[model samples]
Target: MLIPSAQTGLQKALLAIIAAGGVAPAEGADDSYIIEEIRAVGPGCPPGTFDFDAEGQHFVYDEMILWHPDPAGRTVQYTNCLTTIAIDVAEGIQVSVAHARARGHATLDPGIVARHTMKFFFAGDPSGAMSHTELTGPFDDDYDLSGQLSPGGEAWSTCGEPVVLGIDSSLQLNASHNPAGTAELSVDRLDMKIQARRC
Candidate 1:
């Protein structure tokens, strides 16, 4: 992992503990870098409701809920969150989003349906240079889903260039013919494995 320039030994230890079982493995490697910034937007992840930790390697969304009451009487409801992370790394390095996991809870009427979609990509990369996933159901309980980037599916950053990673996720609920029904979805945690290499 890339250590920040201003980080102290204690800070590095704390970050290591927090990032356990999370971030990608590349510790003690060259091309040291730091997460310059993380920007998030959308109704589900408004200001102060979502944040990045572990050196901007992990994301937490507190109150990322999409609720629709009386689906039959109302239009379909959806909520989305878009995040971008800027990484300041030494030149001659490349970065990639290797894996991702999403944990959430959903409550839907028997007839109602919901969809969870996520996409990971590097800024300025071709549209095809991205990882996407979609899962739908009449889910009624907690759920955990994960995705891994295959060898050929990896989206690498441009060698010797700045890296900006974008992650887009959404929860959409569709109404059924039921006269009175409610649908709700809450995304609690989202983890990503961001790896860097010497290119």
Candidate 2:
């Protein structure tokens, strides 16, 4: 059945169906939408900050995005993301992207790309509590993220945190604090150890 769509091409149509992940259609079948049209309605900005004294101190993020014909069969992507030092403020951020895994003779070097899609979770509080934040979609999914942000994803208050995250395999996160919003974060496994100063 070829339903008329305002968009072009057939791949996009099929992509929409398969992209549903596990979200089955409702009882009514008339509900119409687009694949890329599916947007994540969540927090616009990530809240809180990275406390070196508490949650470790430094952290790093990496991932890859590419076309995979088989979702269950293959996840062969060459993606990696990293951000500059950050703290518990609201300063600007800079991120870098590199290739982690690639197939064929092709390779994606750590260069300047654009926005990219991803899933992440963040939790903490410049105050005393904690908070949680999450992003569903509209992923820019770019490459080299010099000025890009890795989905900051969490903004809890005093007792919030990212729980039961349902996103891609990788996530990137960065944060700033204080009036100046300056800090440094490095990663060891999934633990970020921040070494920054807040005044």
Candidate 3:
């Protein structure tokens, strides 16, 4: 999360990014937004394990991991994290999460499978979005999980008011019927694009 001292810097960067998209504001207009609060809960995202980068428009998680360490029997394990962010924006402006990317690593033996699921929505918006990616392997590798949102998938914030955005995610590993397989999956970071435009 960002402190008050960094608010000005974030505002400048955000404004520049928005302007680059051909949505420049009127001269001397200061329609900026700041992250007013962030709350993360779940075993996979404990206190001090998650933070947001205001300038990068991303969230970093240090401890989102799920492991199945036994190679003798079938097992199912899952880890989840839920995060809510409150953003205070200037009047006449609306914001939306235009894109999202997840970076992670996975080590799955033959017959092992893993899946990552995510849900994103605005607090008062009716049309939310859901995305999931699955991986099955016979080896170890790093993976970048990316997906395109459907038309109208972006949930816009209410004009001239603060908005709360929620992100809920989970990682699941299934080693069922695999008598000699082990698996491990870790999600390191979640990157997002916050777009601002006039309402």
Candidate 4:
């Protein structure tokens, strides 16, 4: 009997889930979307921790969830594309589309848009199947930082107060923009708790 490797098994599982129709475009979607969940289990790797090829900007995980917005007003759903999820120990998280069919296609890379001086924390728990993330930066007056967790979840706050939104089984809280675009807001901070399941 031919046994599947751990990586292969995980990939098969992810593909199955994707085929089940979990991915869809968010309502009134835009050009970009954020990562909603990430989960993985493989040999030689911890439950929540996945292998990261820094030079290639590739991430290998058992499973992951992404919030994709359809500019054409289609339904929002999870994606299984080979995307890039980059995180800096001292910096913030950057989710980019490595393929055209994936979410955030043609969108600005969060890493590029994010200010280097920002401070944040991002981590996942395989045991609990959840990820906790937080970040803070200076509010940009030129562009509006408002966003939504899901299709119709809620508008992300640009005020110095914590703005919270629910993405799948995760909760994201952001407080780093000035609605009025007047003061030099501190981009208070954004916190998120994402839950994922092993396939």
Candidate No. with top lDDT: 3
| TM-score leader | 3
Question: How does each model score on TM-score?
Answer: 0.75, 0.19, 0.77, 0.17
On TM-score, the stronger of 1 and 3 is 3
lDDT of 4 by residue, 1-199 (tens): 1111123333344444334443222221111223322332222123443433323223433333222132333322222222212211111222311111011111111221221111111112111011222223332232212222222231122222211121111212222232221111112122232222111
For all candidates, the clash counts are 2, 38, 0, 11
lDDT of 2 at 52: 16
Error of 1 at 124 (Å): 1.4
Ranking by lDDT: 3, 1, 4, 2
RMSD, every candidate, angstroms = 10.6, 20.6, 11.1, 20.1
Query: In model 4, how many backbone clashes occur?
Result: 11
Per TM-score, what order, best first? 3, 1, 2, 4
Across 39-69, the per-residue lDDT of candidate 3 in tens digits comes to 6677888878987664335778899998776
lDDT of 4: 0.23
* lDDT score, candidate 3: 0.68
**lDDT for predicted candidate 1 compared with the true structure:** 0.63
Give residue 33's error in model 2 in angstroms: 48
